[model samples]
Target: MVVMMSPFKGQTGFKRILNATGYSLAGLRAAFTGEAAFRQLLLINLVLVPLAFFLDVSRVERALMVAVCVLALIVELLNSAVEAAIDRISLELHPLSKNAKDMGSAAQFTALCLIGLVWAIILLG
Candidate 1:
């Protein structure tokens, strides 16, 4: 028996960076193309990043807000990727695919909740 490896396996540092960039771009494109919620979230970020500067927030609070927003975007991107992969595999409904998609959605929801919590604490405290 012979073991076969993937053709695209073992990426170097530059390749890793390129792959990440590709994924990020793909996620952004998918968000813009397919997900209205992601678009809304992005618009909210656009407002909040500048608002952070205007507010009398401490450096740490600003950092936290930035981190939370970035995390939310990252998670949403990952969720979009997962969904795309699942759909690519099959458009037909499957329990495992549903589970995977649901889990990805849950991850995004968790990230959104964290972002909300961070903003609430920083702005309201």
Candidate 2:
């Protein structure tokens, strides 16, 4: 048997850490520049995270509120990645591709709902 590996996966140790960090930053930049939904979520995070600090909530509540906002960004990133990958595979319409993209959108929708629920509970309850 033979194993195949990506040439880009060969880095190890400190060099790998540096390369991974660069790649991660690039991914973030790409999302921020290319994905409208990501930019919108980021704007929301800019508002909500700082607002979390000014609220009179306990530390744990503040953390929870900030966390949900961050979670939405993370979900949006994953959703964007999924859509990009699917588009890369094929731009032509296919049922499976549509399903995959739809599932990713649904995941982001759920994350957004979670943010609303968490913020509402913390601010009102």
* lDDT of each candidate versus the true structure: 0.87, 0.95
Clashing pairs in 1: none
Stretches off by above 4 angstroms in model 2 are 1-4
Give the TM-score of each candidate: 0.79, 0.95
Shift of residue 27 alpha carbon in model 1, Å:
4.3
Q: For model 2, where is the 10-residue window of minimal lDDT?
A: 116-125
Superposition TM-score, candidate 2 onto the true structure: 0.95
Model 1, residue 3: distance off in Å is 9.2
Q: Please write out the lDDT profile of model 1 over residues 1-118, one tens digit for every residue.
A: 9989888777879988999899778768878889877888888789877887888999999989888888887788778888989999999999999999999989989988998899
Global lDDT of model 1: 0.87
